[model samples]
Target: VNGQFVTDNGTNIFDIYKEELLKNPYTAENARIAASHYGSQLFDLAKNGFDSIPDLVLSISYQNGSLQDIGQKVNYGVKKTID
Candidate 1:
């Protein structure tokens, strides 16, 4: 989120993952899939997202240079997890 905290409903995805999935790979993968699904749901908000969101989404703008660069920097050299 924005500087280590979510500015949303206070439901921290990372915290939920840690509390529910951290100890088990299967559980973690399940959470990952759920996250993916939730992400896909963002298409309704717009392929990008509402302006209040902190980052651009994958499907809507995967190949743009600026977005790729941002993803690269934040993702430890990995870019475009989806596209």
Candidate 2:
């Protein structure tokens, strides 16, 4: 775990893993997959302008005084006519 805090004997301590922190999460395959899924839509949005596109909202909440306990909610959608 990188940049994570661990509780030991009722004490919270920062745990840093250099190797995990330095690892790259993005890969060529991930890029290709993202492009395959949203390339056309993104291009269209750029060309048409994002005025009509709905705003994306993300909400994150945590509880139990634990970093492991987390929740997220996302709202995203777009409506456009392509002809």
Candidate 3:
């Protein structure tokens, strides 16, 4: 999924993604991993200006009612100034 974050939007991308993860049953273990990874990335991005946010990629697989090697790729566009 592609998303954009603007300061005045009052919406946090990470929070929405975390909620989605919680709602998905097949994403138990990988969800935590993804959250941690993305959370760190977000922190880093926030620390240096919102520019240069990269695409997040992870490997994910579901087998026998279990998730294995879970991964996902998402791109986010952050606009520090809104017109």
Candidate 4:
């Protein structure tokens, strides 16, 4: 959160996080969130600029073999709920 949350600037922060995520193994057992939410979180973090924010939301971790695996998991979960 040691940054600014300006509109264009926000995109850069999200891009960095995404780049980091993509470089890691998809099944690295790390937390993952929707790209949009990730972007939003980056925005919030930038705005906070290292300040403590009350009740910040965080993502949950899951083990996925690849991006395809992540997609399948999401699809399966949704299908199960719909069925």
Clashing residue pairs in all predictions, respectively, total 0, 0, 6, 2
List per-prediction Cα lDDT, in the order shown: 0.51, 0.42, 0.65, 0.54
Ranking by lDDT: 3, 4, 1, 2
RMSD of each: 13.4, 18.6, 17.8, 13.8
Report the lDDT tens digits of candidate 2 across residue range 1-83. Answer: 12223455533231122223334474443655554455566556545676869887655444344332123333222332344
Error of 1 at 20 (Å): 7.1
Q: Tally clashing residue pairs in candidate 1.
A: 0
Model 1 clashing residue pairs (backbone): none
TM-score of each: 0.24, 0.30, 0.43, 0.33
The local distance difference test score of model 3 is: 0.65
Where does candidate 4 stray beyond 4 Å? 1-11, 27-33, 55-83
lDDT tens per residue, model 1, 13-66: 556645566467676657767656754554344434477577755533334343
Which has the better TM-score: candidate 1, or candidate 2? Answer: 2
Error of 4 at 68 (Å): 42
Ranking by TM-score: 3, 4, 2, 1
Candidate 4, residues 43-73, lDDT tens digits: the string is 7676765566666554443434322233244
Clashes in model 3: which pairs?
Answer: 58-71, 58-72, 59-70, 59-71, 60-70, 60-71
Q: Which stretches of candidate 2 lie over 4 Å from their true place?
A: 1-25, 55-83
